[model samples]
Target: MFKFTLKRFGYMLLTLFIASSITFMLIHAMPGDPLAVAARKLPEQIKANYYAKYGLNKPLLTQYGLFVKNAVKGDLGQSLASPGRDITETIMKHAPISARIGGQGLILGVTIGILLGIVAAFKRGKWPDYLVMFIAIVGISVPSFVVASLLQFFFTVKLTWLPTTGWGEFKHTILPTIALSLSPIATYARYMRANCLDVIGQDYIITAKAKGVSNVSLVFKHVIRNAILPAITLLGPQVAGIFTGSFVVESIFSIPGLGQYFVSAITDRDYTMIMGQSIFVSALFIVALFLVDIIYGLVDPRIRVSSGKR
Candidate 1:
């Protein structure tokens, strides 16, 4: 297990390095300079000074090396869009909002999805099963942005139950959370249902039933524990995906989160902000994948035993 964890950590670091390099190269390759974007009307000399000030005048490779060095030292540099603000501090300020919404959505979606899946599996071919499947299909089919728009219109504009947009207050979180969670809920439900159905057919399940195990105990203890393992595998990557994807949701709702800044960073050609966010998100995703691997070993003793033998 220790060796496995160490190997995964090394892979995570390597992945982050490759991701950062690609992002840096790609951003530099794009048309339109950050200086031009940041200071459109400034005189050429002033722009040149700004370029020198931010080390934008340096060679691309030199800039990249500096970026990597500074990043290693926990300095992500300043935002081109905001001028004086540190990219790390900016990310810190906005990440919590995204985290709050994403966290709530994940928990809500997973809980409801697991419950629905259990019911559907237990009552396979019945009305409850059909209903759950139907909902799952709709949830999967509908795009999150469309869901957000409809939710905003009906709940905020027409019904006036929730605010139209903006962060702050519990009411503001509901629409966005529901919108973000819909697809995940559908995905988890489908996977869990399939896993549960497969588990039900396994020899141990039948043996437990034949041994006169109570229905509830049999389902919860034996069935859910084994069945939910696959779903657990999805949770880590899903967490990173949720936070990254929340940009669109945040934009629609006018929420003050990293997503909003991420979008602006692209359009404004804020190179530092873009690179910083890219590295941060990439690191987050890689770490999540690493943690997921560790979690797999923890949840399934088979993996640990297999690793040990190897």
Candidate 2:
């Protein structure tokens, strides 16, 4: 187990480094100048001094090396647009904003999705099954932005029951949460339902039924337990995905989240903010994939044993 964990951790580190490097190169490759962005906000003399002070005149390779070094030492440099604040601090402030919405939305959406899927699969061809599948289709079809707008229109504008934007109260999160979580929920449901139906046909299930287990208990103990294993495998990857997808949801709903900062960082050409956000996002994914690897053991011991075998 320890060996497996170490290997996964190593892989995650490598992946994160590659991702950050790509982001840095892509941002550097864009036409125009990072210094020019500062020049527009600062006087020519001030801009020249700023560029020299920060070594902006250095080669791109040098800048990339310095970036990796500074990042390792927890120095994200200074913000060009939003001066006088540490980029790390600026990003941390927005973490909770995004985390709040994504976390709750994940919980609510996953719960509903798994339940609907299991029910639909177990009762295949029935009215309830068809209805659940239909809703999953609708959830799959509608894009998050469109769903967000429609939700705002109906719940906030027409009914005036929920806030259209912001992160002050629970009401404010209603529309954004629903919009962000819909696709994943639908995705999980379809996958879970298909997997569950397959599990029901396995030899073990046939033996359990032949042994005269009650239907209710069979559904819970045997069926659900086996069916949910695959979903557990997906949890870690999905958590990282949730954070990334929240970028759009946050923009539409005007919620003050990390996603908002990410967009603003790009538009404002705040290199510090961009780097900080990029690193943090990369870290989230690395940690999530690591956790997912460990979770594989908890979900099914055979995975743990197989990893040990190598």
Candidate 3:
């Protein structure tokens, strides 16, 4: 297990390096210059000074090398969009907001999805199954942005139950959390239902039943354990998704989160901010995947055995 973890960690580092390199190169390759965008109306001399100050005057290769070096030291440099702000600091400040909303959304979605899926699987062809499936389909079919809008309109605009936008009190979190949760809830429900069905039909489940195991014991001890394994795999990516924040959801709701910064960084041609966010998000995803792999070993001994052999 230790060796397997080390191997996965190495792979994660390699993945981050490649992903960061690609992002750096692509942003530099884009047509518009950050300096040009920042100093559209400023004189050429001032622009030159700004370029020198930010190392924008340096060759692309030199900049890339410097960025990688500093990144290794945990310095992501300054944000071009927000002058005087460190990119790392900016991300740190905003990420918590995204994490809060996204975490709630994930928890809510996962809990509801698993329960509904269990009901559907247990009931099989009953009306309850049909209703759960229908809701899941609707959740999957609808986009998050649309869900955000509808939620805002109904809960905030019409009912005045929640604030329309901005993050502050607990009331502000409700709409956005629900909006963000919809797709995930739907996805989890479908996946859970399928996994539960497959687990139920397995020979072990039949054996348990034949042995006169209680229904609750059969489910809680065996069915849920096996059925939920796949969902554990999904959690890594889901955590990454939540931490990175949703651009559309943040934008529509006017939440001051990483997603808002990410969008603005692109539009304003904030090179450092863009690169910083990209690398940060990529690292999150890689780390999440790595953790998921470790979890697989813990959840199923077969995985640990295979990993050790490899």
Candidate 4:
């Protein structure tokens, strides 16, 4: 297990390096100068000095080397969009808001989705199954922003049950969380339903049924236990994505989170902010994937044993 973990950690580092390199190159390749906003009105000489100050005047390779070197030292540099603001510090400030919404959304979505899936599987060919599928289909078809709009219209505009937008209280969280959850709910439902049906038809399941195992045990100890693995696999990136923030949901609801910063960074061409956020998210994603691998092994010992041999 230790060897397996060490191997995965090494792979994570390699993946993060590649991702950061690609992001750095792409950000530099983007049309328009990173200094355009900051240097637009400055004299030519002053602009040149400004460029030098941010090291934007350097060659791409040298810039990349400096970025990597600074990043390794935990200095992601200042925001070109908002001068004097450290990119790392900026992310740290707003990450909690995104995390809170995302964590709630994921929990609500996955739990309900798995339940709907199990119901759909067990009640196959019945109205209950059809109803669950219909809901899942709607969730799948509608985008989160649109859902956010509808939720706002009904809950805030019409019923006055919730605020239209803002980020102070718990009420502000509900609409965004629900909007974000819809897609995952649909995804987990479809995958879990399929997995459950496949598990149900397996030879072990048949034998257990023949031996008069209770339906409850058949569903819980056998069916759900096996069927949930796919959902667990899907969970890792979703966890990472929370930190990246929900760009649309945050915008629609006026929540001040990391997503808001990212969107503005792109719009303003803040190179450091963009690259820092991207690298941070990539690292988070890699870490989450690593944890998923560990959890995957724990959930199914066979995977660990097979991987150990490899």
Tell me, by TM-score, which candidate is best. Answer: 4
Candidate 1 residues 182-240, lDDT tens each? 88889889998999999999999999999999999998899999999888889877889
Error of 1 at 34 (Å): 2.1
User: All candidates' lDDT scores?
Assistant: 0.89, 0.82, 0.88, 0.89
Model 1 RMSD in Å is 1.8
Clashing pairs in 2: none
* Clash tally for model 4: 0
How large is the C-alpha RMSD of every model relative to the true structure? 1.8, 2.1, 1.6, 1.5
lDDT of 4 by residue, 1-310 (tens): 7887888889899998999999899988888877776679999999889888899888889999999999999999999878899988988888888888988888899999999999999999999899889989999898888999999999999999999999899999999999988877898899889999999999999999999999999999999999998778888788886765487788899998898888888888888999998988888888999999988888888887898887
For residues 159-217, write the lDDT of model 3, one tens digit per residue: 99888988789988888899989877888888889999999999999999999999999
Provide the clashing-pair count of each candidate structure: 0, 0, 0, 0
> What residue runs in model 2 are displaced by over 4 Å at the alpha carbon?
40-45
**Candidate 3 global CA lDDT score:** 0.88
| TM-score of model number 2 | 0.92
- Global CA lDDT computed for model 2: 0.82
lDDT measured at residue 138 in model 4 versus the true structure, 0 to 100: 97
